[model samples]
Target: MKKNIFKIFAALFFIAVIVSCRKEDPLNVDFSKLNIDNPVANTPLDTWLTTTFLNEYNIDVIYRYNRFYHGDDRDVAAVKVDKVQPQMQTVLEGFLLPYRKVAGVTFIKKYAPKQFVLFGSGSYNPDNSYTLATAAAGRNITIYDLNSFDLSDPNTIVNKLRTIHHEFTHILNQIVPMPVDFQLITKSTYLATWTTKSDESAQADGYVTPYASSQPGEDFAETTTSLLVYGQAWYDDRANGSTAAGKIALKAKEASVEQYFTVNLGIDFRALQREIQEVVRNTYNYQQASFPYWLGQNLYKSLIVNAAGDPIYSAFPLSTPFSLVNNNMKTAIAALPYGLTYNFMKLNFTSSTAMDIEINFNQGTRSFISRYAYTMDLDQATGQTKFTIAAVGGNDASWVGNANLLRPAVQPMLDYLSNNTFVADWLPTGVDAVNYNKYGGFYVLGTPANNFYGLLGQ
Candidate 1:
């Protein structure tokens, strides 16, 4: 009925147009009144977007502000022409490439959002909050506050990427449902007035952030995306800061997210995490994403140096000061009256302020362990740790007999550790991502070539 009514109205309009046209001759009609210029003419940005996004992935980038793209009530600004490319460059490197590396090019091309809409200013809310990003129908992602973007600021890059990943996670959930087990992990704690809650408070209740407490869907997205952008170190810091129950809940959610990506999506989340962290470290140069940063956070409890056996120590060229000391200790211990061979040394970081230099040795079938305690002054900001030997000792008979007997032999290694301040860092540059966490060591602050690295363990 509506279609027939529209057709009748159209016929009446056509008759009126014919009568009007008869009143004026065809040549007399004015053509200059019509506007003929293309409003959507291709700019350089358009051409780049076409080749980079549209041509490669069938994605459309709409930076020209159209009021219809946003809500009627909200007043948003158009994206600055210059800021568009840099913002999208981050999207390409930080978001798209990580997934491409881990999940494969085809997976992202299949599941990635079809359109991106950029806005200069934020999409403000009546509640005094603003939207950073939003996704619709698994097809469109709109990012706001592009005018304030700073490519050089790691936090700015991370914040934008986090929101993008968060929205993308929502898109993925729409395609493949999030695990029901994730929802049940913190079911009773969710709040409708989540805005009133602080992130600290929400984290104590097992939510990754305050927004996550709003719903189970947001919880899953926050947990997944936070890990992806902030890296595992940030997640570990949050988990460690939570209450006992909250820690358990967060860990459970992490496991669920791992399972979701690994089992449901056929993506290795850890491998994806490594790829993303590499970008965070190398591309963004985020200090918190580095291994040394986590070491200071006490994420890894111990670092073992077995120079005589492990080849990685040498591969990282840990041979200079550390290998020299390792071989000397072996020689000195071998020269003892009885048959004794040197074993690996372990630096047990008992706490942020304390560590134990545990020296191990073998005589025939028996292994003797001696421990010397030291207080550490760690400047986490500078990645430097200063060690000072404790005046007292609770040394057992083994330490008294073996350590005292071998003190002159091991004093050189002891002085090497205690005499100078060292900068802690991951030693292997350009090594495989799998081996990143496998080795970390310290270089003497003033003398970098005098450094030693070892296998790390929790």
Candidate 2:
């Protein structure tokens, strides 16, 4: 009986210890007094952003100041409310539309950053360098200096578009690494203080820009952005202006960049550049109707005709027009009168009222062709165009008599071109609406009372 009582006591003690160690429910406390604000109401800008960016590409844009989106110590401010729409519109037209048209919407949808953060002020560094734009982790882009944006000004618009392209290129590189050969092109020229270098010096060293010399990755991005932003002519001019060795290296880099887009992304870089340029012109409301525009669209030529409306010494066939090919004049030699063969002709515009004209002539079985250069000038006030022989070389003397025979006929056409009142229709045909090679029309010189000479652009 005593043993049984001890067992019951031990069991009771174990139960007590288990109950003490177990968690116990305590008194409930009221926490309703804690203050918490509701979410801010969506603004019109937010609605627009939702429709433009988020709805289209699932990308978010933040124009309002948000501390979380910026670096802790960076000097930046929120984009001005008024500049936001215009800036965003410019970005869409200048940057995004080009990629969409060239690379396809799906490509951008997949590769574009998920978010864009805009700032009114540039993120200025202690070293006097300013950050224009940057991509972060391939997920976000931050564009700076929106407050000073002027879409009406082509230069400012181009510069801002360039920054966007530069950052976008970085994002693209992050997705698919640039070729290792690109990095090796100017590997030794990479510098920590690239800001100190001048653009000419950097270009001479095979770098597209001073910032491009900071690193190989930046170099690739800079090269691509420069090509896209400045267009092909500008890029070619810079490359050709560089030293011979530098030109070769820069061209190699360009080829690599182009190959990266073509082989890897299936994109034609030139077509892309052309598309972007068109968008830029349309977006800026550029005046495409002017004398300069007409001049660029048409190929000008002078024709010599007799009283019976017959050619005396036409450089090209009566029907054939001279056209610009690779920046040089070209025409067909399929039809020639008097056993005359087509050679070459060039027109270099020195200014609004002056041009340097060069023409070459060839005869059957002749060892050499005759070449002559002439200075063509226009008196803007009087609207009179005059041509004076500048330099005569090659076998040109042999053809001087034939040329002189047609001088009387050619003078009238020259007078018509010089006349400011002369009315001529310029019709441009081709992809760009200004490709003189494809369908350059003729200019009707003189009235029916006088012999008509049709001067065609070849």
Provide the TM-score for each candidate, comma-separated: 0.82, 0.69
User: Model 1 Cα displacement at 416 (Å)?
Assistant: 3.1
The sequence of per-residue lDDT tens digits that candidate 2 reaches over residues 299-369 is 23432222123232232233222222211222223233345544443344444444433334455666333
Worst 10 residues of 1 by lDDT: 30-39
Q: In angstroms, how far off is 255's CA in candidate 1?
A: 1.4
Off by over 4 Å in 1: 1-41, 306-321, 338-341, 350-354, 362-368, 373-402, 418-421, 430-439, 444-451, 455-458
- Residue 372 displacement (Å), model 1: 3.5
The sequence of per-residue lDDT tens digits that candidate 1 reaches over residues 54-83 is: 998899998887899998999999888789
Q: TM-score winner among the candidates? A: 1
- Candidate 2 ranges beyond 4 A from true positions: 1-39, 285-338, 349-354, 367-429, 432-458
